[model samples]
Target: MLRVFQECPELKLSSHGRKMAKFGRATPEIEGLVVASGLSPLIMCSLDTGDRRLMSTFVEYWHKETSRFHLPVGEVTITLDDVTSLLHLPIIGVLHSFELLHVDDVVDMLVELLEVSIAEARVEKIQCHGSYVRLSWLHDVYQMKI
Candidate 1:
């Protein structure tokens, strides 16, 4: 995932605060909270823009097995083993810490992520607001149109 972000020429590390984004680094306590709240860990990636502002986007949690898998199915605990297994889960909303980024750059970065880090995920749909972008990824699909 880091390698994919590194390939983007437009992506640079933020200089002021926490310089880089961390992936799958949720501590045990944090994971426990997320599991209890039925909240999946949404993978967030950030980059520094030309103007020295931070640009970030939310990508589906391709590796959120810990929290998402242990959900209760009626009386039984069911594990979602497939990457696209969470299609039935409702996306409550988009969580944005700062202003959303442009659609094109977000799209490009997601494509790179799919191509590099997660080779099995598929982009099912892309919803673009004026500032924010939301994407849905399905089960394994070899070729991506984008």
Candidate 2:
């Protein structure tokens, strides 16, 4: 099994650092809003880079067909309950469906949400190269606002 894993192709892990770690703690005002939004647990949760060897072993055991880990003991699958338990996040909530919006719409949203000028919003959109903006950018904007 160890030899098989060693022979297998290396999994391409993301190079991006942990977003949550950089997020830090929210201000008193923002903390209230976060709690009201039922995302307080996420704020409380601390993140750390886990054992890559263990992760690689798990990846090797993962069966794509059934989406279960074919461990020597038995098959196992991570459930929503597991996520809730591990992360202390609320599983029950209104499901948010994200739809890709036009660049103009994204600009409009940024302007309205961040209270930035249209020109500023457009510049941010151009910098991001799409509708998706960096959380760090958002945080900076939010800090400026406060």
The top-ranked prediction according to lDDT is: 2
TM-score of each: 0.21, 0.68
lDDT by residue (56-119, candidate 1, tens digit) is 2211222245443221232223354432354344344564365566655555544554342322
List ranges where model 1 is wrong by over 4 Å: 1-96, 116-136, 140-146
lDDT of each: 0.37, 0.76
Candidate 1: Cα lDDT at 129? 39
Instruction: Kindly report which residue stretches of model 2 are placed more than 4 angstroms away from their true locations once superposed.
Output: 1-3, 6-37, 93-95, 142-146
Model 2 residue 18 CA deviation in Å = 5.6
